[model samples]
Target: MSDRAEKQTGGLAAVAGAAKQAPGRGLPPVHLWHPEHCGDIDIIIRADGVWMHEGSPIGRAELVRLFSTVLRKDPDGYHLVTPVEKLKIKVEDLPFRAVTLERDDGRLRFTTDVGDTVEAGADHPIVVETDPVTGEPAPRLHVRGDLWARIVRSLFYELVETATVEGGRLVVRSDGEFFALGPVGAGVE
Candidate 1:
């Protein structure tokens, strides 16, 4: 491997080790880490929710899951953070894809590709923005701490199916909060 490639591999290993050692069984406290910024890594999260390293997809599911625990979105950009290092990475779109959705007792819970389960509510709001060029809706759900997951097409369709017309808008309720899926009769049916 080239020198840079070797360095990246070493960096990844270090971060992985730190993540394993992190306290608690749930998600790591990436938000609490204020490590100094290390240089960028050649990791890219594609728009389709595939993670690429050195221009190739990372085939190891466990590794991806481990890295996802340390992912944090700062004011500048997305990063993989450890207690001692914070490496910037490129994200073509959101860092995750909402693959599955479940409704339980009037709450919409979404599961992301990386195994995060988040319920849509005031804290994790769902937002739909229209693509300026294609004029299509791009819906997203806040996962945590400024990180968002793009709701997959199938799940978005499900949302549209269950949505109710309220005050001239198509809305869905979760956790006592009403979220507008889209304006009523705006070609969203």
Candidate 2:
């Protein structure tokens, strides 16, 4: 149809082939890479546009729509990273509520400020007895869900990313490089 579409459908295969052609984003330690990047899947770093079947970017609006849709459709999956591996949390840090994880071109960040911090009440134990003369357990933490991690990892999602709508181009990036998601539909809003 359009030049963008042609590139999206055809040359994108070569672009997808460049999956091995990893760019030097100089990413921080926190921005995690996806576990799988095989047939029909090209996961780019700090990229722009939508994720396509050919495993390439499908332009801007398309990418935004798909990302929003995936988020709305699979709210849980949109926040956490994929390839769910068991992580070690503290028992003393349990009995909390929500969590927030942010990803930038920099690193794979984790934040667990779910709810307001309440004073340690009688309902919860002040300290966890490990051996004999130990102290309190410590501050609590919660890992984000799977879908969220996938969305974050796949698109390099960030919470405070500045999105500027100029002349129809959506200049969206975290820290710097442009990014987007795939398998898109209409814009959510």
Per-candidate local distance difference test? 0.91, 0.27
Tens-digit per-residue lDDT, 71-147, candidate 2: 11122112111222111111121222223444445432343222222222222211212223343212222122211
Best model per lDDT: 1
Q: Write down the TM-score for model 1.
A: 0.95
- Who wins the TM-score comparison? 1
The regions of model 2 sitting more than 4 angstroms off are 1-148, 152-162, 166-171, 181-185
Q: Residue 82 of candidate 1: its Cα lDDT? A: 92
Model 1 poorest ten-residue lDDT run: 22-31
lDDT of 1 by residue, 1-189 (tens): 998888788888988898888546788888889989978899999999999998999999888889999999998999999989999999998999999999999999999999899999999999988868778789999998889999998998899999999989989999999988899777666
Backbone atom clashes (below 3 Å) for every candidate: 0, 19
**TM-score, every prediction:** 0.95, 0.18
